[model samples]
Target: MSAAWVLGKRALREGRRTPDALLPTLFIPLFFLVVNVGQAAKIFPAASTEFLHGQGYGAFQLPSSLLLAASFGTAALFLVEEIEGGYFDKLRASPVPRSAIVLGRLIAELVKAVAITTVLVLLGLAFGISIASGPVGFVLLVALTALWAVVFVGFMQIIALKTRSAAATNSAGLVFFPLLFLTPNFVPRDLLTRPMEIAATLNPVTYVMEALRSLILEDLEWGTIAPGFAVVLALGAVMLALNVRVIQRYD
Candidate 1:
């Protein structure tokens, strides 16, 4: 446990040293938020009357922005660097548990994800996107965002350990772009076409989006939030288990 803590600290130190790599996690969300909200405001009165459930588009899209910001990670970049440089071999030779190495970095990523989520949520509030469930909903947003980020990390860990190539691991994040958008990102699920509805139903991201959106638009809709938790857990468990197996194989 102490070894994991130390490695977690190391992961944070590396992130602090290379802010450029981490900045996009925050930047992409803010950039899109501004553009989307700006476009929405121009048509607010009319658009709100449609499928928004009587809310502005900013509130509708804020969860997606937070999701994007919190979901980006290094995808075991530092671990790959250490492996290439032979530093990781030295650590592997130590008595520390193999899983600690991956879990430690993932823990750091979750902390960073929480920070990003908090900042984006605050920014959303500043821009007039209110949470219907108030303080409790805001807290739920942070927790859900962190869990979502952890889910991404589980998948990235699999890629990082299996490929151990910086290029391949780094590009792993590209998968998220499509997963996020193929669902009800820009619009509500009710407005989605038949094909999109079919895809979204099968896609866990759709539930995630709906969960976060419910927090923003409705008061503690347990029906909406519970499915998100289930999807995240079910997916994260499988991905994390795969990573553990990969680590055992290479260790």
Candidate 2:
């Protein structure tokens, strides 16, 4: 645990030193949020959009942006750099537990997620969006979003460990784009066409978006929010296991 903590701190420090790498993670999401809201706000004004539950279209779209922000993690890229620099080999030869190496990067991702979620939420509020679940829900929203980020970074780390290539790890991040778009980003799942609705239903990212939308557009509805947490936990478990296995077998 201590080793994981130390490594997590080191990762955080490294992130601090490379703000340029961090900007795109925040910027792209913000750009999507602004563009989506601008394009659709008129069509789905809060005054008439039942799905929005009296909130602006920005509220409905905020979760998509949050999820996008969480998906743009740099941990795997950093891992590739460590591998190429031989630092990863040094850690492997040391007394650090293999799991610590993975958890350390995830811990840093969780921290970054919290910061990114907070910034985006604040910006959402600035755009006249409000959280119906209030402050407690706000906290839960950030926690869940950050957990999803960690889960994604775990998958990316698996790629990093297996290929040990910066290019492959970066390319792997693009896979999340289709996952994001396949969800009901611009409309309610019920409102989507039959085929797209089924597609969105199968997409796990849909649950995360609905869960976050519930927090922003409605009161504390655990029935709606629990599934998002469940998905995150399940994905985190699988990703972490795979990451550790890859590291254990890494040459």
* Best of the candidates, TM-score: 2
lDDT of each: 0.82, 0.92
After superposition, the stretches of candidate 2 with alpha carbons farther than 4 Å from their true spots are: none
Residue-level lDDT tens digits of model 2 in 113-231? 99989999998888788989999999999999999999899989998998889999999999999998889989989889999999999999899989999999999999989999999
Which pairs of residues have clashing backbones in candidate 2?
Answer: none
**TM-score per model over all chains:** 0.93, 0.98
As for candidate 1, its clashing pairs are none
The count of residue-pair clashes in candidate 2 stands at 0
The CA lDDT at 168 in model 1 is: 87
Residue-wise lDDT of candidate 1 within 50-153, one digit each (tens)? 64566678888888888887666674777777878898788888899887888788778878888889888888888777888789988888888888888887
Off by over 4 Å in 1: 40-47, 50-53
Could you report the Cα RMSD, in angstroms, for every candidate shown?
1.8, 0.8
Backbone clash count, each prediction separately: 0, 0
